[model samples]
Target chain A: MSTPKKILVHVDGTERSITAAQYAICLASFYHADLTALYVINTRAMEDLLKARIFLKDEQMEYEHDMEADAERYLNYVDELAVKKGLSITKKSSRGSVHKEIIDLVKADDIDLLVIGELSRIRSRRDEFYDEAERAMRTVPCSVLVVKDEDKVWEMYESLV
Target chain B: MSLIDLVVEDIVKIPMTSNDKPDVLRELVQTLKDAGQIDDFDAVLQAVQEREDKLSTGLENGIAVPHGKTAAVTRLKLAIGIAPNGIDFDAMDKNPSKLFFLLVAPPDQSGPHVEALAEIAKLGQSRAFCKALVNADDAKEVVDLMKGE
Candidate 1:
């Protein structure tokens, strides 16, 4: 395919997600693509937890606030990584269903590529039905890249110089 | 690094004597210098003041995490001071801040610094935890409470 004009990476503070961000940065730098990093605070999960009585109303609020902090932390880390490579990246965060937020950004931003970490292990049929990242990859109009092999990716990132 | 690991007994002060924001900040930074955690006190203070000038680090719920990035410290150093009487730290909620967590780190160590801030935000969610820390009698008690002991 033609060089991607825009790329969006999803980060969630996970090691694999970080590796995915690094891979996307490398790709963006090589292709001179505009990069956007997004962190979706899984409010749907929190709501589900509340519904299941696992979280009380106050607990939900506190957890959401904490999640917001987590989002900023992850996005700032991505910014640092991009700066190290002399690339400026746009950082966006949302509070809602993770996949819905991602797909909406993909459509609105006209992103050419959506890079994500290895689809979280699908342990059950229910997971396949409910996984946000998996659903986003399947539905987004853009091409998707599932980054894996953390060691290789880390090595590649370190070799960027 | 975890908050427990970073905020040891040496830097934890209960019933902090400072009744105002700048004084509290001064006491915490001085505590770190006295503990030999950082040299070039002026450089570290300048870094923190610059960051504070941009925006108050005083979060809601009686918690203020005043952090800075500077070369004066090679690694992350944390100092906690509790003033049960409360000090106005320009918190978003407009409530007096009772817990002060001062973080100083090298510029290259942004990752840990951000993590520490996020951790503080999460911990602030627990009102009980903050209360316990403030009501504690001594620095060792403050450290124990932070350690979840």
Candidate 2:
């Protein structure tokens, strides 16, 4: 494929996803493409928790609030990395099925490439979450780059800490 | 902020002698204390140990990022230990972990804490970088290797 014109990376507050973001940044830099870092809050999981009555109403609200905070922190980190690279990225977050939100965003933004971490390699807290992650990977509209490199994708980004 | 900023000349210990996970952790925590990064070494050490008790932060590729956030530190601090002999960190890969990055952060500063941990995790992926890190003659070389990135 010719150089991608747009790239979207999915981050889920995991180390592997951060690595994937670094990979996406490298590709964006190489192709001079527009880049975005997307974080999906996995509200489905939260809903399931509610259905299971695992947490009380106030507890669920507190949990959701914490998750939102985590999403903001991570997305900001990606933004910081982008700024250090002399690049800017659109930071977007959604609350719903992680994969569905990502796929929808991909179509909406006309992304040419979707950069994501190797989901299977990194263990998700829930087994069903892994299934959702796979489904999103399989259904994305554009080319999908599952970043699995055990090497530094961008030296300069890492140095930025 | 970069990990380099959190590290000083004494924050890194090459050729760590502790053979077990707990001892190695203690040794590294002591290193941080000696660097004047933390005041209550015992409290910080316990926090790290408790984190490890939850789940080993040991990743694949012989790297482990053991981290904790506590009031012991006013800001984010890092201590690196390279055990050439490889300590049994109970890593996911079932391999001995040689590169150790111990991160201590204040409870309020989650951003820098996570950033430092993620940076080390990404750095763990580079074979050449890890190889060079292990081969570096002194703490300065290790710092240079990280800063040279």
Candidate 3:
């Protein structure tokens, strides 16, 4: 705690992720903390699909490229939002199990705080089991903030801009 | 960007005549230029060479991706060459490389290029896939294989 010096946000291309990013940017400005946003490409799942032959080799490659593009698009949008508030934030993307990547970076970088969007609504035990963001929240060893009340967070973001 | 969207018969050379590394690189880059995927052959070649000089793109499993980013292409472009005979490209696995993927792009457009590189790496994991591509008889066949046909 001691006023988190490094803040990490996990973006997964969801509407809630954007809300989380905006909230993180606002908080970074407030506390002068270093903010870094990360997106993991879920190569683990892609490999599983390949193993099942659900995706052909070429299809798996193409799908990975598309996912990478998605990651870049989301990261760039978060960067633009941070820039609008005159804050320079770090953006990073990795390819692996989403939750594992988040946990790894949190441990490696000694992230003081981790911010994430609202957890996906769990439809079943398996759904909760597979939700990477929810898994990341449970696994990362740091203060976790789950941004909700999208309208209120959006208003705060607009005020900063 | 889907790797298949950039995949085409015009840019693929099967049973490549080139027997060596430099020639294979030249042949693949030339394929891109011939297909109008790149305009400045010299710049594209140099960029690829510079990248190769720094580190070999030769990966294991008979795959080699020689790539670079430059103003030669407006977007990410790919050219593939299959050398059944294999050539020494200083591969990490120390084996000759048979599949060559030449990629060029605008300097600022790195996302697609990196994605393409990762795609090739992922594709290398499948021996069956690599074998199918290597055994392809013609450019159309190669394109079809890459298109996942």
Best by DockQ: 2
Which tens-of-lDDT digit does each residue in A1-161 have in candidate 2?
58899999988766667888988887787789999999876666556544433224654565567667878898999988888888899999998877799999999999989988765543323222234446777899898998776465656456543
Q: Could you tell me the TM-score of candidate 2?
A: 0.52
For model 2, residues B64-114, the per-residue Cα lDDT tens digits are 878776888777788999988799999878999888889887764543454
What CA RMSD would you report for each candidate?
11.2, 12.3, 11.2
Cα-based lDDT at residue A35, candidate 1:
98
- In model 3, what are the clashing residue pairs, if there are any? none
- DockQ for candidate 1: 0.02
lDDT for model 2: 0.75
DockQ of each two-chain model:
0.02, 0.03, 0.02
Candidate number with the higher TM-score (1 or 3): 3
> Model 3, range A107-154, lDDT digits (tens) per residue?
989998999987644222212123567678888999899999899999
Error of 2 at B83 (Å): 0.7
Off by over 4 Å in 3: A1-161
Query: How high is the TM-score of chain A in each model?
Result: 0.94, 0.88, 0.94
CA deviation > 4 Å runs, candidate 2: A1-161
The Cα error of candidate 3 at residue B90, in Å, is 2.4
**lDDT, model 3, position A4:** 83
